[model samples]
Target: MASQYSDGTLPSGNIGRDFYIPGLTPVGGEDEGTAFDMHARQTRFNFSSNTTLSNGKALKATIELDFMATPNGDERVSNSYSPRMRIATIEYDGWLFGQTWSTFQDVSVLPETLDFIGATDGTIFVRQAMVRYSAGGLSVALENPETTVTPFGGGGRIVADDNGVPDLVLRYTLKQDWGHISAATLIRQLAYDDGNAIDSTETAAALSVSAKVNLGRNDVRMMFNTGAGMGRYLGINAANGAVLNASGELESIDSSGGLIAYRHLWSEQWRSTLSYSWFSADNDTALTGMGVTESTRSVRVNAIYSPSKELSFGVEYAHAQRDVENGLEGDMDRLQFSAKYAF
Candidate 1:
């Protein structure tokens, strides 16, 4: 179970939006008032199996699901729930095939918080279908491809025309007795063809570096990511990967973001984390539109108590701000409480 109270304007997805860009402020209107909500949608379930192959190897498969999807806005009356797929993967030898965390992301370096992803605005948060190979802390993958584009006039978005190419990602990690470090790179092709003589294509690329250091009972985690046209890959799709210029040509956006978190243990069963994240994008207002998001930032602090490994309780406070290219800005502050039990 969880309860959340938010003050000020926030984007869709409620608390989940805290990690992404804030929604634009209403024209000539003040930000929204305080809002409160509660639910038990974070409960999840998992299934897994392992089989031994004839060649003395092992094959593993797993499927995980959670009830986080809200349909038709009937949370109070229907208490509606939908099964959301979190992970479905198969692994054999050093190869992974199916949907899982993106090759560009390092979950080990993520901060601990009640919110889904602590550093929403700065982290590479993505999960999709891919074929990956791993060997000695090095991994490479070819992931599913889809391009998001802001139209020339910029009222809505358009899907890029199919370009028979998948995203390419490479990552390497170094683990030491004191800490660990990782670096990754991604490249993809963004294309669009309206079929009415408007056709365009652009190449996009991104880089990420992450690290975690141990200090007795405390630790530190951090990540930095930057790219051109890294749209849906970073910042939870806060900006388009590509947008049409005034001449109807495709162009990628430049963005950079990073996060730092520190964890402290007050006792054997009580601990806390303090984290900060920020993201900024260079949007060509004359080409994309004035409504494009310019920047977003957030701060989070949380404490958790675990009587046992199966049950835990936590409380968190988060503050976030967003700015648009047109100079309009909005901010949000939220308090969240959660209790969970694992079987």
Candidate 2:
């Protein structure tokens, strides 16, 4: 997607993290001017194959890639593109192993939009190495683990620490003719060893529920998620999962988020979706560093036209608000357009 910003600078870092709005303005003589950008980094390639095992079991594998590298700070000369891996997985019988979407997320209920993630600020979005087993409408997984933490002082930046155990997740789905409902639970072990004889560890957990209802030619989708120390998993890591207190102990933060969306059909070739998302974190000012994000919300509307099953075009408008723990707030507006073709 190509986007133009009117009020504030676009968020930096990982593309997924960029989906969240920033709560603080540019400081230290930094630029806060309007910006325009156009790119086709969303284009991707997919390779898949299926086979039958000697034991009469089915086997499948897939690999996906795209060009969304950071440009290495040289956007003026070479716009050099690089291939990045998005998914690589193998399935045998009812088991899956490798890297793909998190088992805690329900991709089927996500809203459609021009941006990479339509309701990212409130959505459960992540991809990591994992081993999962499925039966009927229930699934379980053990995923890679990492913990993020903030120092006791208010000026230090957040840092990630290695984990001692993997994350565990359980999910179940109920399907009917009119709609479907899904629920998931997650448990994690967070650990930190600063090599300064000040080591700490903590346990975190979260819950998520989602639903989609079909109304003839239209539909409604919704999701709600809440947890303690669910940092990088929800809201694209807008807040640290845990913080170091004055005594150098680990303390988990409280967070909640959700999104609601509706899709309407204008004709056989045209359709539109309207979505709104909200996310909030409760951080202790004395424990967490200052200037941390307190809350974020966004609204987006888009229209898409598909002349053929293989080609489509879309345009979207979005507005977002960010609030900081120190009472500072910022606003952002964006216009995005995209064209996609699949083979």
Task: Give all candidates' CA lDDT scores.
Answer: 0.82, 0.81
* Per-prediction TM-score: 0.92, 0.93
Worst 10-residue lDDT window, candidate 2: 20-29
Steric clash pairs (candidate 1)? none
Residue 56 of model 1: what lDDT?
93
lDDT of 2 at 299: 91
Residue by residue across 132-250, what tens digits does model 2's lDDT show? 99999999999999888878865655575568889999999999999999999999987778888658989999999999999998999999999998888887787778888888888
Model 1: per-residue Cα lDDT at residue 278 = 87
lDDT of 2 at 9: 56
Which runs in model 2 stand beyond 4 Å of their true positions?
Answer: 1-8, 11-32, 71-73
